[model samples]
Target: MCSGADEKGGEQVAGRAGGMAALPAGLAAAPGNAAEARARYFNSANAFNIHLDPVPAHIFTAPAAAALGPEGAVTGYFLCDQSARLGCPWPATTPFMLARYARIAPGARLAADFAASGSIWYVIAGKGRVYGAGAGAGAGAGAGAGAGAGAGAGAGAGAGAGADAGVAEESALAWSRGDVFYLPAGASMLHADGPDAAVLWLVTDEPLLAYHGLRSARPDDAAVHFKAGDIAAEIERIHRSVPDAGTSGLAVVFSSEAMQARRNLMPALTLSLNTLPPGCAQSPHRHNSAALTLIVAGADCHSRVDGETCAWSDWATLVTPAGAPHSHHNEGPRRADFLIVQDGGLYYEARTMGFEFLGG
Candidate 1:
């Protein structure tokens, strides 16, 4: 369960679960569907270097979808879809996972929604009040909260002094830009947008349900209210505590207090922030899970996925297929940051979160 050492002299060593990952033998035989197993994992024998081929994959960056409700007031952007011919095995056999960007109309609230997949939401802009009432396996994310299966009520559960002050089995927190939260599947959520509308990117694990023919549970809704307030403040904390924490710029992780967070590999998924110092490269590393990264800050950053390289601007998104060797480099003078949402926890709980690190 050991994770690769961080450049910060292990200060950033992330805990690991499960054991090393390996392709199972006879997965094509009894008790296993080779296709389903393949959809969940990649062959380690294949080279991990993946590239975006000239530009960042555009198929995932389509413009936001508008008119999300009967009121025709809500706007949303779905970053990743099941239609892309990106050689991804997801959304077909497992959950149809996708990252989303959305703009809620001012003063309007999304109708109540519930799905069987956990969701993660980050308040990238504007302010709004969120409310959701649920117990057991949910809480703290837009309109609803819970601990979920593998984890318990998280998101707002734990906070350092002045970090997120309070979080419980209630989703009645006022949120602004920078607050990130989690929503467990099956938890009902409803949100009223601020007077100025709210912009956010959401990540979810719904494809699995769809793959299983549970299409009726999916619906459009919102994400979180535990505002982080200042991105710089969190970045500053990382720099002060571990200057040169290896891998280009600095990075930080967002996690919940309960043993089971609805939005992690344990229950489903999780989020992290990666900041590359201007014009630096992060160490090359690969894990057993795929990642969906949203460009949150800086610009003109190119990611090298195995042999393919793709460039994207601020607010764009990139993907790293499970087990694909990938790395990021800041192509501009300003610091570049990204929000990394991944399903690594799935491998973690299954004891197969194997990973390897190459020098930066």
Candidate 2:
């Protein structure tokens, strides 16, 4: 009798602590005998397959192959439907909508506009500067009740405190490669390209606002831009802090929602950078939150979600559905770096998320 249970390869980690998981709905979860149930469901050839509901996560690769706009940018898309059960048209959903891989011509700027929903933009390559002011929201596409609206007003007010106070009515922030910028709702901004063409990756939470009441969401929103630092520091920190018995990689969470005291930029979404050493991999694990992973630096790794595998490369994106166990292996010589943006904040706040470690 092969009761295929008691398998161990890696441990679990998440915003919350790990514990026994609830059976995947309809299935009988063995409270005292997880091993027996695991054998029946995970290993046996004759085991029944009860599919997971829906996971929220999407990945895009080779976004440059997407149709180009007249300005030459590839506005490719990667969509995430929060629970896989709800759409953005409903106020209850957190829709990540109208994503784009913007390619701005050298010295060209995306016309200044405003938006009702807050958004995030990441500089993929080249150089650029962001120009905006708290006052611009009233004139551009920014207005109405939306996420991060209050934060924009606070930033504008704070800027007015400098010695150039009287003249500090508006401002512009310059950014280069590897910067992750956020625009709070109810603000205006223009993307000015630098000497070289810039490829920008953008993410927005507009659909949820539209579904609730405001449907005319636009591109320009408000939020703080987080410039990505050298990855070596983060990797070193991981080696010094994290033990070797868990997930095989190192990661740092860059979350605006976490630093809520200083007028946090994002309300729900959080962005993180992760790295896997050469010839290493992260042990597989599952949590209730979904992840949007973009392979920004290295292509030596491929990702596995549940049983499916994607042969990914530089600029490849993957969406991890909520509750699906997954992992990434660095098959190349160099380190594999990637960006993971997720809605784990909400799950953590609601106390509905659970994490578990499954063997890779």
**If scored against the real structure, what TM-score would every candidate get?**
0.63, 0.63
Error of 2 at 270 (Å): 1.3
Model 1 Cα lDDT, one tens digit per residue, 1-360 = 224555665642333322223333334334366566664344433335445322123324553323122343433333345433544434321133566555555654432233445567777667765444331223434333322212211122210122112434343556677777665444433344555656667776655454465633323323332457455687788877756434444666666554234444225566778888887887788887778887777677788887688776556667777777788888788888788887776777788877778665
- Candidate 2 regions with alpha-carbon error over 4 angstroms: 1-58, 67-98, 111-117, 133-170, 214-222, 230-232, 240-249, 256-265
- lDDT by residue (1-360, candidate 2, tens digit) is 123223343333221223223332233465467755544333222235535334343455445334122344422232222333543332212244334455556654442222434567777777755544332223332222222211211112112112222222235556778887766554343444555566666655554455455633334433465655654466577868856665535776665543565222455566677887888878888888766677776655788887788666666557777788898888998888887766665576777768778874
**Backbone steric clashes in candidate 1, count:** 41
The 10-residue segment with the lowest total lDDT in model 2: 152-161
Tell me the number of clashing residue pairs for each predicted model: 41, 18
